[model samples]
Target: MSSPVLKPAAELASTNRTRHPNESADYRRARQALLVEEIELRRQIERVAELRRALPEGGEVTKAYVFEGERGQAAFAELFGDRQTLVVYSYMFGAQREQPCPMCTSFMSTWEAKLPDIEQRVAFAFVARSPIARLIAAKKARGWTRHKIYSDTAGDYTRDYVSAVDADMPGYSVFTKRGGRIRHFWSGEMGMDTADPGQDPRGAPDMDPLWTILDTTPEGRGNDWYPKLGY
Candidate 1:
């Protein structure tokens, strides 16, 4: 199906109805230019999403990975339950660390409230290298009731999907189940090597809203600041 032809971004922006009392003409002119760019940015975002959806089938998941969670031991496929799609978040809460990575925790805190909305379309799970009890304690501390966390006891899944050596880091991976086969779908690949100058490595359309909110502010996610477990 073809989409209806739309007016050019500049044309649409020029028709913007926003008006602030006592606004200067110079400000209005600059805001109109910014609106045109914002319209183009929206189109670029949709274009990238279309490209992602058109990707070829990803590799099949063959390993018989096992994980232990609150309910007990469950095989990899069991994580999906009934959903055809699964979303997994690998957090930085390995055995070496007494506490979870503050950034990962921050991301999870944002997601904690969003799982219900997300799960309507995909199964979601949180995985870590720490024992199930530790993960549960952290969840309790964070007051998360719905984030289903699992422990990668043998590190098999972590080694393959998260890190080659099972290094403690954060990750987001998606898997799909269909025709009795599960295959890796997508995951954030951008990292330190992919980072732009004077910026931290981050995913396209970053998964954390904290950064998104910060990006709109004048301070603009200052390089020296990071979220601590506490103030």
Candidate 2:
């Protein structure tokens, strides 16, 4: 069946804006033009998400990897709990680093509050290279109560999925189970090579909503500013 015709987003965006009493004609025109681009950007975001959802089946997860959790060690498959899908965020807090990556911590703080809603669909967990006890301590220090935290103490999962060289890098991977077999689904692969000029290599749909919210403000994410472990 053919899709129904709809009004162009730009045209729709142009029609409903209310003018402010103190704004000048120039400001009004500029705002209207920006609105058109904003509408187009929204359309592009949806298009990208559609493509992501339609991706083909990924490789089978044949190796039985295990990780350390607060309740002791657990098999990789067990991380999914009762859910069919699992999202693993490989945080950059390895044995070599004294502190966790502040950027990763910042992004995760947002997820803490969103766990209840997110777990209703897919299971989510944060995996790091630190020992299970250390990871738990950091969770407590961060005041996060909802996220499922784990440790790749042996670095097997980290080397296999995040970095073969065991580099201290943040990574995100998703997996799903079907017919009693687990398979890779998707991952945030965007990095320094895919980054735009003068911008940090970041995955689009930017996993962290912090940057997204900041982008909407008058002063966008600055070139030098980055989240620190402590203020």
Candidate 3:
């Protein structure tokens, strides 16, 4: 089946013309500037993706880590199931924290909605530093029963992927497997940033497409927004 269609903002703008007169020239200019910056940013990101695709594969990982699934006790390989590629999001939910990271929760909410489409290309799993029991409880509380959840309580896998560093480092990493060999494809700590820590003090730019799309709206992602447990 074809991938789900995502309508671009420009297309929508062209088709729908209903601009408010009170919208000042300055406001229009700023909005146009933002749209131009977004287009250039997308081109630059695509270039970076090309470079990443050309790089040599990273090291392998086969350590056995435990996880809690719909069927109870599950292993790392079992989480991967039959898929060739596995994309793991290292969620920042330590064993002591009362709740999972809110930002991470937001991203997972989007992922949960697209689980079926994601499963078509590669398998997806959420790995947290919290214990299996804690992870399961959080999942149940969030009502995320369809997507897979796992625990990296020992910090072995999270450390390997560089997703867990001290208590603040949060990121995403993708890996692929063939036979007994596993190779890292891509690892991005900066979700919407331009550079890493030392390169720029500002710390990478936030270029998440979801945020960009939301920026085009009137409320602009809104102030009091949180992912609900259910739709």
Write down the lDDT of every candidate, Cα atoms only.
0.93, 0.89, 0.69
Total backbone collisions for each predicted model: 0, 0, 7
- For candidate 3, the per-residue lDDT at 65 reads 63
RMSD in Å for candidate 3, one decimal? 6.6
List per-candidate RMSD values in Å.
1.1, 1.3, 6.6
Which has the greatest TM-score?
1
Residue-level lDDT tens digits of model 1 in 1-231 = 776787899999988999899999999999899999989988888888888887889999999999999999999999998899999999999999999999999989997778889988899999999999999999999899999999999999999998998899988999999999999988989999999999999988876899999998989999999998887
Q: Write the residue-wise lDDT of candidate 3 on 1-231 in tens digits.
A: 554564564654345344577998788767665665666677667667777777887776667766655567677776667898888877878876778877677667666667898898898888777777787888878778666877665677766675435463465777888886777777775443655444321212343445656767887755566454345
Candidate 2 per-residue C-alpha lDDT over 136-208 given as tens digits, one digit per residue, 9 for 90 to 100: 8889999999979999988888888899999999999999998889999998889988889999898877768
lDDT, model 3, position 113:
67
Better of 1 and 2 by lDDT: 1
User: Candidate 3: misplaced stretches above 4 Å?
Assistant: 1-36, 68-70, 163-169, 191-210, 217-231
Which one wins on lDDT?
1
Off by over 4 Å in 2: 1-4
Give the backbone clash total of model 1. Answer: 0
